[model samples]
Target: MNAPEPSAPGVRPEQEALFSTTAEHYARFRPGLPGPAVQLLAGTLAGRRAPVLLDLGTGTGQVPQALLAAVPRLAHVEAVDVNRAMLVQSRSVLGPLLGGRTLRLVHGSAHSYTAASGTDSVAPDLVTCCRSFHWMDRPAVLAMADRVAAPDATVAIMGDGSLWTHRAGWTRQLRELIQRHLGTARRAGPADAYTAPVRSYEEDLAASPWSDVAEHRCPVPRTWTPQGVVGYLRTTSFANAGLFPDSRHHDVFERDALTLLTALAEEDGPLVEQAEFRVLLARRPGGAR
Candidate 1:
């Protein structure tokens, strides 16, 4: 596979330097796949015989843990991450469920890690990447997935963009208040503010070595208390806890997120929104295409 491109401008440095430092907080704050999303992913692949799984950039094992409930017959599961600290934390969270069979956690970069030298097996029956797909170089990663994945294997990627900012009117205003307080440029929409520059599912899958590709979209909803929202932001890449030598920026981000949540909290009901996620699936070619 070709070398992964340098992260787009400011994104690379912040993602690498920041997330590892705040690994624990990130693991706690990062959202897990809702039941429906997991079910949808499982439904597509359940027919496969004895599927071995590889979850790329499996920070804290959220994706894998969710998958356990949906696809219980998992023969083998391997998770790879760039940050060793994240893998360690994932081991703690994931060890119990995968007791008898050792949970495979590899410390490596997804952009370049060849499956042959890296994993005991050269190709897995299934390969998955969650939110971290945007962090790696897309072309190289897709090529790597194509190379390392088994013939007839299905590769999947899923992301829930604009997760926190899904509420329309109140969400829009709350995000505005936070940006103003943080003294950042005002964004067009709450989702726009945190959006990352990555290839669309259609574009990336079309360019890869897959024979047939399909897109599945699901609205995976989850409720967040006022406190949960604040806790969630603490684990974000934009918080830049590591980028800044001091913790002041983190404090600022937390405070602003709290202010927004507090203002929106209702008398009896919790703040909630319709969180939508997209799953892109591609099947590796069975023979020379």
Candidate 2:
């Protein structure tokens, strides 16, 4: 997911800064949307001869990487992100996936992305935001999509719970350790606190141009190594490097977390999570693809 653009108002500063320092870890450790989720996103562009994708908060190009492989008619992708480092990382990771197709990386928040987003001329067939919609100014972003999206375009708001939100014995213990270091309140940014959105994504879309919606859920089982678990935490809002008081605090937290995860992995066999990857397929009520 992409962060906040320093200029875009109405979004939290913490949202923009969540994955800033851990760009590399995010590019490496954050898992892509499963096969079923990608296929559902692809299905939206069913009849378009050459579909263009506008991936808002295109962190490390995960949405495009999955969709490009699943939808061959997808010829161009204009990926926007708030972090330059993430865009740099995205370029490298998405390079191999583009078989002579176009993948343009735009540095801006989803709330900030527009038709004149530098070289981005994306009147996209399908607009996607994977693991990223929560970080946006939802109404503003939908309005932007309304202006820029092609006729009959589909907007897919997709995400899954993070390791911090997962339910499991190891996850419970891991949360406790994180709380011990960062406090009980989940940290969303440096010096900034976390809070729930005033409206759900569904409610936000209901009041926007994309009023009609359908949701799809894919249950995915995942296993993680102790090291993999640590890396994923390094990219999360509650436990990234930014939340620590100092380098020593971050280091100690990592050490303690690894120790905890290793023991759990040994005794429980695997550090596992049953994640529900969800896609909210929204389109304007009267529009038909």
Candidate 3:
């Protein structure tokens, strides 16, 4: 299937496929959800004997990799991604990790993901959308979750702020440098500028069937090397190579950004990102479990 056309509240029509071409960079350098956040997500499955997971926007299979590592007893996972390349990367990353457990990949939008069957045994005990909710039609996906999620299943919407949203002296400098190359508006894909979502994730949750909710915050301290920073940027929508007019333009930008980052790292010691993983745990009105 072709990639999902961007029409979600978090993603406008312009930011198509989001990270369609950066699968390798995403698998390698994308600082996935924090360990504490993954642990918290894992903790939600303790009530189930052999928990099954339905992870939306399972980019590069980070959430599953982290969850499976944390919970060895995870029975099965249904990972969905609109970008087939991401799913391909997911297969490689998760293949070695799954010790004979089941992993089914759905190549479509999250809202379009349905279980292979309607049996309770196949319904997911835990449903997670991490770091990718902004790229989805929130209401539609949650509605779909209501249909497929187990009666007592927990629906978690989670993510953290990125370096583009970070406010630090050096990060601001880096953002400025990126703007110089890509322009003032934060580039979404090769064609469009990004717009902040009109509604908050909490608002979307409150309006959906999964209205009963709890918010969790995990403070994560991260240190990045100059090269690590560059690799990570390669995966970002704001500064990816596609946003540049040409490969040569991108190369120059990366070169200049690295020089600035190296200098900043040396002067400031360690380049740190004080990121917080936030999750909205939503359930039915009377609660599932």
Best by lDDT: 2
Q: Per-residue lDDT for 1-289 in model 1, tens only?
A: 1122232222343345546565787667677787766876676566765567788888888887887657777666778777666777888877777744446676667766554344366357777898878767777878877777777677788888654346666567656655554446533222224455565767777888864777788876667787776666556554334433358765776677676677677643667777778887777655322
lDDT of 2 by residue, 1-289 (tens): 2232334333345555777788889778888789999889889999888889999988888898888888887889888887777788888887888887877677777877765446546589898998878877789899999989998999999888888789889899999999999898888877766777888999999999999999899999999999999999888778989888788999999999999999998898898899999989999999995
Candidate 3, residue 80: Cα displacement in angstroms equals 0.7
* Each model's backbone clash number: 0, 1, 0
Q: What is the Å distance of residue 248 in model 2 from its true position?
A: 2.0
Per-residue lDDT, model 3, residue 210, is 88
Error of 3 at 238 (Å): 0.9
Q: Which runs of model 3 end up more than 4 angstroms from their true locations?
A: 1-17, 117-121
Give the C-alpha lDDT of model 2: 0.84
Residue ranges of candidate 2 with Cα displaced over 4 Å: 1-16, 117-122
Worst 10 residues of 1 by lDDT: 1-10
TM-score of each: 0.80, 0.92, 0.91
Q: Candidates ranked by TM-score, best first?
A: 2, 3, 1
lDDT of 3 by residue, 188-258 (tens): 88877887889998899899988889998998888988899889998888888777778898899989999
What's the lDDT for all of these models?
0.66, 0.84, 0.83
